[model samples]
Target: MRVFATLLRRDLAMLLPGGRRGQSLLPFLFFLAIAMLYPFAVGPDADLLRRTGGGVIWVAALLASILPLDRLVAPDIEQGVFDQLAIRGIADEAAIAIRVLAHWLSFAPLLMVAALPASVLLNLDGSTLSIVVLGLLAGTPGLAAIGVTIAALTAGLRGGTALAGLLLVPLATPILIFGAGSLARPDDGGILLAAAISLVALAIAPFAGGAAIRAARDS
Candidate 1:
């Protein structure tokens, strides 16, 4: 537990350095801005806003989550941290878990925070807001897991951003479907199904990503 906490703190310190330019703050704010613009561009009808809020929020969350993938492994790889971890006594599985957890920590909260203003812009009610938050909580882990895999695969590649999106979007369709479906009918079984799928994805993706990272390291 202490090791995990130390690793998380260390990674956060490295990723979020204090400076005039906050590294991730801009991108996160940009995501929020974009999400807020959707309802205005569609028109000012409250019903339309309510109906579309789920899809808009889900789509924005997915995109926002994707934005951080390129940076996930790049800095560590560039700084030789990846190489050091590879040769260190720590188990590869543990290291991969740490990396994935750290990535989740950095990216998921930003997406959730961004979602708040978006919900308001879309005129989401309490139910929709709750659904959106729950879906994000359930789905973002899957996003991070898949992002971790892509980050590892493209850790050394030049056009990683495009490649990561190409690889990720297809895999992320199920999550999008479930997440949006949950919001569509928060009272129905759809939301539960979505939550179930998200939970499954959350459980499965990390193991798959960890294996992929280990294989990538070996190759």
Candidate 2:
């Protein structure tokens, strides 16, 4: 328990905004940039913006989430942090599980907060904004999970960073589909489905990530 807390704190420090890597806010800013540019790209069509804006926000969020995937586990692996944790009898699964939480904390909430400005930029109405927020809250965990898992899997590989981004797109597309789909349709089921997918990912990430780390450690 104490060890987990310590690891969690370390992760938070490194992963949080303005941390050592200096890339913490990249995704956040990237998300906003897309939102801001979208209005200009599409021209001054209020109805068009209102209709497609949610999907655009969703796409922006997906891309932003990928920005940090490369560093998600590679840095820790390179620094022998995982090796030390193993020596200390802290299982990789536990470490990855904590990392998942830290990962989600690192960007998910900030993205939700950023969505406020994004909504304004895209001119989303109250109901659409509500759906967007709800969908993001339920879906970002899965994004974090997929990111961590892919990071673990590719930590030691050549071009792992590029590979991680490529891998993230397909894995996270479902979340994007349902989350963004909710905005297009008048149904709340999409949000619910997105939440279910997130729960499943959260449940499976620790074990899958743990195995990947072990494989990487051995090979």
Candidate 3:
């Protein structure tokens, strides 16, 4: 338990602002850029923007989530961090689980906050903005899970970063679909489904990532 906490703190420091890479705000900035660009790209059709803004935010969040995929596990693998963890009796699955949690913390909350101003930029109504926030809360964990799993899988291959982005779009599309779909339905079942998917993704990521890391280590 103590080791997990220690690993989690290390990952947070590495991923958060002023850490190693120093790009902690990239996801937030990229998310807003997409939201801001949506208006100009589609012209000033207020109703169209309002009707679709939530979906646009969903897309932007999904894209932004993948931005750090390359950084998630690749560097650690290259640096033999996992090898060291193994010597300390820290299983890869536990390590990856911690990474998944840390990754979500690093970016999901920022995107949620960014959604506020993005809602204004897209002219989202108060109710719609609420739904958007709800959808993001439920969906980003799954996106983070998928991101970490893909990062582990593609960590060392040539052009893996681009490959990770490509892989993420498809894997995360279901979350996007259901998350954005929630805005259209008052039942809120879409958000529920999105949340369910997130749980499943979260459950699977650690084992999958650990296995991938082991495979990478062996080969």
Best by TM-score: 3
Where does model 1 exceed 4 Å of error?
A: 16-22, 186-188, 204-207, 210-219
- lDDT of each prediction vs. the true structure? 0.72, 0.91, 0.95
Tens-place lDDT per residue, model 3, 1-219, is: 788889989999999866786798999899999999999999999999999999999999999998898899999999999999988889999999999999999999999999999999999999999999999999999999999999999998999999999999999999999999999997899999999999999999999999999999899
Which sections of candidate 3 miss by over 4 Å?
none
- Indicate the worst ten consecutive residues by lDDT in candidate 2: 13-22
Q: Write the per-residue lDDT of candidate 2 for residues 48-117, one digit (tens) a residue.
A: 9999999998999889988988778888889998889999899999999999999899999999999999
TM-score of each: 0.85, 0.97, 0.99
lDDT of 2: 0.91
Q: How do these models rank on lDDT, best leading?
A: 3, 2, 1
Ranking by TM-score: 3, 2, 1
Misplaced by over 4 Å in model 2 are none
Kindly indicate the candidate among 1 and 2 with the higher TM-score: 2
Query: Residue by residue across 24-122, what tens digits does model 1's lDDT show?
Result: 565576678777788679989999999888788888777776776777766665676656766765554565567677767776787777778788888
- Single out the weakest 10-residue window by summed lDDT for candidate 1: 13-22
Candidate 3: C-alpha lDDT? 0.95
